[model samples]
Target: MAATLDQVRVPRARAGRPRTRPDRVLADKGYPSKANRAWLRTRGIAATIPERDDQIAHRVRRRRRT
Candidate 1:
């Protein structure tokens, strides 16, 4: 679930349009699978999701590029 403030309160505090964009977003690991990250990148959202442990290990072993 979204934070309570986001769901019911923050919308009313928007300074401009209802679709006002954010300067950045902070996210947890669960939100940044490959496809999700790619989609967010396509839209220019700066995602801060960290790689899962298994993903980190695999990347290290294979020298995969981000």
Candidate 2:
């Protein structure tokens, strides 16, 4: 099976053309991960993914000062 989209725009094809990238991407619960955030930062893409419950608990346990 394959997904035949109406149009596809990739960042790789346009080194010469101006890159008008999106400001941010919003992913739901299934995509809340540290690596995902880091990757988005590398590309200057803001993410709107909420932290998972386990991640929130760990952060709260270790980062009490904040």
Question: Number of clashes in every candidate structure?
Answer: 0, 0
Candidate 1 TM-score to native: 0.61
Q: How close is every model to the real structure, measured as TM-score?
A: 0.61, 0.59
- On residues 1-66, what C-alpha lDDT tens digit does candidate 1 reach at each position? 134213332243647545433435677777667776676666575767777898889879888564
Report the Cα lDDT for residue 5, model 2: 15
Pairs with backbone N, CA or C atoms under 3 Å apart (clashes), candidate 2: none
So what's the TM-score on candidate 2? 0.59
Check candidate 1 and list the clashing pairs.
Answer: none
For residue 66, what is the lDDT in candidate 2? 62
